[model samples]
Target: MTVRTLFDRCRAFQARMPLAGFFSHSTAAVLHGLSLPKALEGDSRVHVSVVAPTRAPRGEGVVGHRVDARPSVVLVADLQVANPVAAWCQTTA
Candidate 1:
């Protein structure tokens, strides 16, 4: 999908979920400003991790992060973008 289109989709999906923060993994290398060090990037899923105490309400785009893994890091919803995985790919490549 186009970058703008995908970002819109992710933003809508994130709006529905009840999460504190969401982060990107391999797909978000560039979005997180790690474009030069892409050698460490891995995984296939557009993995978007969240830092919410309760399970985030499901919608689409993201698979939703579980609370069991994260022990800390919970910032408020002040994000500017979503579906950062795709954004990273666009930036890196």
Candidate 2:
């Protein structure tokens, strides 16, 4: 019950993976658990596709990614739902 509650109350979860930088995109994915496939793993900077107003990539305790109230998914709780693009199952897989 504790574990479930812990999980339920949680939103985004990012480990301090000892990475070089905690820039914008990576920060969002790390804290939010959203995957950044197109990004290089070691860029030490964040790069999201959306151009947000008041978006700044630097902050204290945040090595790279900076999070704010935006339309995109900003937490782990967000992953349960699918994105706008339909994810098709590949028969080949």
Candidate 3:
């Protein structure tokens, strides 16, 4: 899918969630303008995470993570996204 379409999908997914989790992993990396491996450059899945006590989101085209600690978040393209350090660690994992 095109980048604009992917972003619209992510927005829709977040809208369905009760508490919108922050975008993480590859998704955050893209939002932050970080370089990604070629394998991940075209991935369309939205990576989202919520801190513990809040259940991880689940849906088509989404990879969800339940983190024990609250991650630092920043606004990117009007979406909540994990900070660079947290996103890097998540990508490695």
Candidate 4:
């Protein structure tokens, strides 16, 4: 998906989440202004992660992850996004 489309979707998804979760993986990487491989850059899904005990979000166009530990989060363009280190680690997993 185009970055603009992904960002618009991200905002909509964030508004629907009941509890706190942060954008992670490729989604967060984009929020952090990092370059991604072309394949990942083109992906349409947004990666959203919540610490365990809070059920991960489910919906179309979203990839949800339940993490055992709370990842560091930061605000990016008014959206909650995983910190750079956390986002990078999530990508590797």
Residue by residue across 1-93, what tens digits does model 3's lDDT show?
455776787688777654747888888887777777777778889888888878888878888888888788898777888999888777777
The best candidate by lDDT is 4
Q: Give lDDT tens digits, candidate 2, residues 1-93.
A: 132332332222234222222223333334344443553334333233222343433333333232333332322443321122211110011
| Candidate 2, run of 10 with poorest lDDT | 84-93
TM-score of each: 0.41, 0.26, 0.83, 0.87
Q: After superposition, how far is residue 64 of candidate 2 from its true place, in Å?
A: 8.5
C-alpha positional error of residue 75 in candidate 4 after TM-score superposition, expressed in Å: 0.3
Ranking by lDDT, best first? Answer: 4, 3, 1, 2
Ten-residue region with minimum lDDT total, candidate 4: 35-44
Winner on TM-score (1 vs 3): 3
In candidate 3, how many Å is residue 17 off? 2.9
Error of 1 at 31 (Å): 4.4
List candidate 1 stretches off by more than 4 Å.
26-47, 67-93
Q: What tens digits encode model 1's per-residue C-alpha lDDT throughout 1-93?
A: 333444455455555545454545443443344443445343333335555566654443355554444433322243333354444543455
Model 3 misplaced regions, further than 4 Å: none
Error of 2 at 18 (Å): 25
TM-score (C-alpha) between model 2 and the true structure: 0.26
Q: Tell me the lDDT of candidate 4.
A: 0.82
